[model samples]
Target chain A: MRFDLEIKCKKIVGGRTKGKLLLSKKPINFLGMVNTQSGEITNTSNGFERQNLKGKILVFPNSIGSSVGAYTIYSLKSNNVAPNGIICTNNVDITTASGCAISNIPLAFIDNQRYNDLVNCIKILGKNKEIEITLDTEEGKIIID
Target chain B: MHLTRDEEKGLSGEYGEATSAAYRILVAIGEATDAEKLVPIKWAHVSGVNYNTIGDSGLEFLREISKDGKVRVNTSLNPMGFDRENLPELSPEFIEKQFEIARAYEKIGVIPTFSCIPYEILPIPQEGTQVSFAESSAAVLANSHLNIITNKESALSALASALTGKSPYSDLRIDENRSPMVEIVNETDLENELDYGLLGYFTGKTIQKSCTGICNISENTDMWSLKSLAAGIGTSGSCGMFQPKKPSKFIEKVNYGKREMNETRDELNTSEDGQLITFGSPQLGIEEISKIQTLMDGKKFTKPCKIFCPKSVFCKAKQYGIIDSLQKSGVDFISDACTCLTPLINKKNYDSIITNSVKASYYMKTSNKVSVALKSLKSIIKGYTV
Candidate 1:
């Protein structure tokens, strides 16, 4: 997944990349599942149970569940167990978006045709230690370099 | 964006630091929704339950700030299941801590009437009534069905809006935001609360990211059915907005729909397989529990059944020996938190669960990989268990 990337957010500030990218084809609900304080996927039924985001790009279709899901994301960030960047098939839910804005997590939504191709490439790249994500708001594309 | 002068003044700290904190939170929330101004509100409904995800820290912070002065507002709250009745005979120290938290809110004029369906106690806002509500499920119902205006405010922002009686004019406050994006047409006969629960699940699963309005409902819908639908939708999707066009006809619709759906599925309906019948995903209120006791007085469970309710109501039931009699009849009564959200139980233990709550059925579908049947409490006791 060596390509250019663009990002769109309320605001964007550069931060260090800490880990690999964990992708989920489905949306993730955090209310009863994720432990906000510990940043552990305490939810046994969650698709990403026991998976650590520490420094990974958490890719998901979108966020599901309560408005508190946003707060949980912030808790994860405060606990130093947040995704480095988020790549979503669509816009994150308002609650999760608010959490990302508050926590300053880099997020990019892919709405372009290239998204399908990019997703396939990213999956093949698997979880990497050092991958860069860029978002092009005008093009509605997220590039992984 | 569309802020009233009063809201602007509060945000600018004309009221006080506590109000200022609330204002900041509201402003952030308003900005998130791309709202330009604020709207005046009459009532404020707050979320009081401690779901570990929201944490106790936010509540603690609000309490600490409110200790300095009164909040100058009228407010209600979503119930927290914990209460003296539920956890009776606790240490004085524990009681003191709980009182301290309550006192903080009391100082700010928060009436701690622990309930989510405040409309049951307080008057529901009339159509186009602008109010500030926090709880997502309630907010959606109030805004969509009642045609009341309330932004899906964040926890602190809801408190701030309540204090000032104003919120940033946004999607919910504006008339245009009330438009239904997704119209859910019930093609099948939705005869009961369980059917509505299933309908809500199916709708949420299908139409993600859209506010749904259930239209053309069969005449059999009831309050319990609608509430179940709301609960299921709330759990299955991010939809906090739902308006049943003819809410007044809900009960009639549920009755009709239940009979039709059940009648159609009769061949598929099985006998009482001795599975557990659980209630109160949102925690049964006192009235609901009393109704259950009355219904179960002469009945014995053919199979094992468990009723989970808020600890507060559970205590009253215990004092009245309703708990004992129910337990003696093989119906285990447990209280604390909602069992629907409780991860302590194994899903594989039960062949199926029968519940009256639409919210429980919705969550169970996702949480438990089993056949969860919905039936009225009356039906359950009568052995017409699905």
Candidate 2:
């Protein structure tokens, strides 16, 4: 398939899906920062505050705070409100990896260089336009629009 | 990552649904962390037990996994919401949900110790043994003091380890990563466990390494002080381990002097006084309880005081008549519960709480929404028990 942009990433959890990218510039602590019932980002300090993570490919720098954050991710899935996929711009911490693993959410990690390219593309394309991100594990690439 | 045939089978669902799920989780984490393979672990101390922490979603997953999952290794549990025998005046809904979580873990064949300090009650494996511990304080202690290997596992990863007896051979488990990347020197004179806790909190917040070497700590620092240090670092940052060694020639260096110590103390101590006094965050072992008993010296607490510890420790204390003696002084000994995230101390009933544990203070302020009057155990005993 042809794509406007493709970034190489190390796959943490294997699967393929496409969704609008929801970027979080800061690290997230899912336990308290997210409303598990609705999969809404409750942390007001983060840019994506009050944003529902239901169908977006939630991208973040990292995951921090309590280990219970992993369970919160699982909670998001069990509530039918999890993101289609998660892509970390940095290392995939235990909280993100384990949560994505148990919940079966496709997880991938992009290096700093590729992440910058993705960010610049988003900036040029504008945030108002929906940017579909495809986590193609079989091809080991994150295809973006 | 490469996988053995057995692991491959487990991942492919040949070994059953639960094992397949466990293998999948391990493989995913292993690959993410660049682990070539999985290593066998002897124990797994899992967290995510508190109904307050995990909520309905965690409960749902636990129930589903427990249907076919049984631990392959010796597994212990973290503290639940409240004491099972002496249930607090919580909502019936909470009690029911908490019990459901308990049943799920029990069904999955965990030890159900409901104590975070599993090293205290359980027989610790020989030195250099690998284990998966989700409790932060316990993970720190296992690495720093017990000479065990772990990566400060999350609740789900530890649970997966318990199910499969395997962990990703990366992070802290790698021998090269065990050494400190930074050196934290204590430039201030320490007085009590509270001081040690502050020093640890400072190191944890400042140092950006997997482990650090702490210098100038007395060789004879008590267990309470070490426990406080472990609790402090575990709460403040992601650094899972520390060593009480002198600064090496290489690596970055930071000093934990009075300024840093006072800053940490100010950060955690939010209240002037608290209605309740709690003794444990990493649950009180017999040593701490014995020290408290000695300090109490038959003096009654001026206010409500509770000591959270393991049921095994409580039993031992009772056997030694220490619990009975402490009870006479109006100190409620709560077993199978912890000070952190305990529903027993809530904003509705108590405006604040006093504890020596920075870890407990952090959780009480953030999660429980109650202010904390953090103090040294000695000071608390002297001031409140008179």
The runs of at least 3 residues in candidate 2 whose Cα sits more than 4 Å from the true structure, single-residue gaps closed, are: A1-5, A17-26, A38-56, A118-138, A143-145
- DockQ of candidates 1 onward, in order? 0.29, 0.53
Q: Distance (Å) between predicted and true CA of B149, model 2?
A: 1.4
List the lowest-lDDT window of 10 residues for candidate 1 chain B: B247-256
Model 1's CAPRI class is acceptable
Candidate topping DockQ: 2
List, residue by residue over A43-144, the lDDT tens digit for candidate 2: 565466578999889888777556778898888888899999999886787878999999889999988999999998898788687788898765679988
Tens-place lDDT digits, model 1, residues A1-145: 3455444333222233434657666677765456566566655544565876667777677766555566666667767877777666654455555556556676555554555666656556564545556543324445567
Cα lDDT of model 2 by residue, B236-268, tens digit: 666789988887778788878878888888888
Candidate 1: what lDDT?
A: 0.59
lDDT of each: 0.59, 0.87
User: What is the Cα-based lDDT of residue B361 in candidate 1?
Assistant: 53
- Candidate 2 global TM-score: 0.91
Best by TM-score: 2
| Candidate 2: C-alpha RMSD after superposition | 2.9
Q: After superposition, how far is residue B327 of candidate 2 from its true place, in Å?
A: 1.8
